[model samples]
Target: MEQAIVIRSEIRKCMQEEGFTLGGFSKATEIRGSYLSLLLNHDPHKYPLPMRHFDSMIQALGKPEGWLYECYVDECFITGKTDRRRVEPFLLRCAELGKTECIERVLSRLMENLNQLSLVFEIAEKVHAAGNQQGAVPFYECVAEHEKHQHSETLAISQYRLFRAALGQDLHKNRFAATRFAPFRKRLPVEYQLDGLLQLANTYYTLSDWRRLGECADELIALAKVVYQEQHQRKTSKREKTPLNTERHLVLYYGKGYLSKATAYEKQGLYAESKKCIEGYADLSWFEGLDEVGKKEVQMFQIFAVANSYTLEILMGHSYVLSEYTNYLSMHKHEILSGLATILESANKYGFSVDETLEMLSKEILEFKQREDLPGLGWRLRFHYYLSIYFLGKGKIAECIENTLQSLDLSVIINNSGAFAQAVALFELCRGQATDAHLNNYKGLLEEVRKRERFNLGFHNY
Candidate 1:
């Protein structure tokens, strides 16, 4: 006789009328099958679903959103079925021991009761920390889907976790996971907001969206300053235990802000500003606690800035910068291929014998070009341009022109001004040896380059 029972019976009737079996409904709504059975067959007075569930079920059944809510008994209150303190330790132990199936079982049971979803979040976090990101992803998705309409903070945390796990997958290389944070941005705490913004800037770099990258860099830098000042005013601990970094969020945000800004400046060909930003990035006062991978990434960025500085110096007729190029390359053996090319080019310019380096580089370039999936259009363009330079250094004029033509073709395809500039410059240098066909194709490619320059998009492709 309970109104809750009546409401549940009506929901079942509506579902049956629409020919939606519990399993079909579960599949359509992405709800767990056992959980759907609990909603349809359990004692509604004891195991009532959340209001959000009613809305989702109704929407899936092509009913009005509030039909189930209107029939619900006012006295039915959802309460926790299991004590979280007792359940969490067992789940955490299972996760720590790598019992993924056991963890999944516990999560499924916990998620069946509406009030036990917090425990689901806790168990998912444990699984994530146990380095089973793929396993944790589904748990986070469940929590987010169930809690999205009513619990903002839980939804934000769950979605962020899901996004991070997806980002870690190699299949997601060309995808920008940070854009998934938009819907949850306002619900995230200040520290997470900063983290999200940092990732957004990284995503912009991946997509080569320079204008947006600059905007995000400026926004993040401003937010970092404000958050740092507030934390300083509160006299918060200088270090916080966090999953992201050992230091406080302040230092991590500050470093990321400058790194992103420097990248934007470098892409815009403002080398001096980029150098200043990179220096600012390196000077952030938390290196003592930075993890090894983080340290290496920062070192790589510094090497990028230094290599750019060296290139600018050479272009401006200051060969003195080459004095330190070899030392820099030696210290950073894992420098980017572009950086390696600068060092080798500098060596050639200085009349140093780079024969061994050029031979090794030629082999490496050939291998890269043979890969089925080129890393990116810009990287491939740079590789071809660098190969041309290497071939020219080896006195192979025909081979050099062949590579230059490849670079020019890709530059035109991608509208990459910087690569086009390099290709055109190389073409001019090689024009003396060109046959009639080469001359005609050169004119067409040169005109395309001129049109691109006239457009003045100013984006650096390399």
Candidate 2:
């Protein structure tokens, strides 16, 4: 009440000092004089000003944006209840202006009545759908924090959005987000469940947790099949068609289900099982209801199937396919990073020399190293790791140590503990051969890892 009164009084004082009558002020602000007079004279405790009018007055008075927004948070309440008409727009404007304190104040008051959860969730969806994902985090966090029903769809969707928004280059954070959202995956709408499972599988893939990745892939395949079958049945029957609003074309979910499974198996060294899963999506072109996008996805899967077949052969010690695989990679530049990694790994495993192949793809390797995207970084880390192994196997001690240090640096940057452990162990085994410069670089990387660990520990503790 006091804050509201102070705002009104300040407006009145500004008008009086500027020698503007109510009529003049109203004209400048494009508000009616009668309404302006009522706003100034009415007891603010009983009749709070609307946010739009207050905004107009601020602009007319040449005040900065978000002038009196702190006090405006009070105006959003009337008689101790929220006025949705005022609060919603005010909240959005606050978000636009980066008035986080005001947003928190308004949300704190709004949450006092748990009935506002639906409204809050709606605003979160609107913000998220607008591509302002970070802005929607607070609203989603508020709903997830106060939601009493663990099984509620609202809670599940909030968790799903939070999980999607939280994903980034940080593997540790991605793992945490995946774990937090996994329990709510089944509770989401079927459409969300499909996308959520795919996200989980990808996160697990990044973490190198092949077992969990396979589980999510299996669940994704099951749900996608159910949805696909239901759609087919609806099409065949006379029932009115209802569309599913998924993030991607329906076939993507289905194809990714098999693709992710194949990747999980390949990572686990189950080449035969991986080949079978690759074949699962190899001919999804026959899947019904494929639009242009779906057709493209099917074509992409076919390409992946061919590429991964070559990869499996290489991993299984078929040195005969090296030239063919290199040709395929050259034609499809996008596959070069992973392809080269696989080639290097096979070379190390089979005790074969890939010196000519490496020299030929030197440009591609440099480009891969320069890429900073999460997937690019991930593959680069693997490339360096595998390249180090190849170098060690070839008795090139200097090249091995350099690649090992590079891989270790990347592993730390991405917070990939599994790769970091492997790189550290390899480095330890080769420590006696490291030059002074190599040892210095290794010590520096270790310091960086220690600093990051301390920061993570402090954050979690707080």
**Using TM-score as the measure, which candidate wins?**
2
Error of 2 at 23 (Å): 4.0
Tens-digit lDDT track of model 2 for 300-399: 9888989999999999999898888888988888999989988888888788888888887888877885678777889899899999998888788899
In model 2, the clashing pairs are: none
lDDT of 1 at 379: 58
Segments in model 2 whose C-alpha atoms lie over 4 Å from true places: 12-21, 428-440, 454-462
Q: Model 1: clashing residue pairs?
A: none
Counting clashing residue pairs in each candidate, in order, gives 0, 0
**Tens-digit lDDT track of model 1 for 178-278:** 56665676577776777777766766775567777888888788887786666555555666534433223355666677777876776676878877887
| Winning model by lDDT | 2
- Give me candidate 1's TM-score against the actual structure: 0.51
Give all candidates' CA lDDT scores: 0.64, 0.88
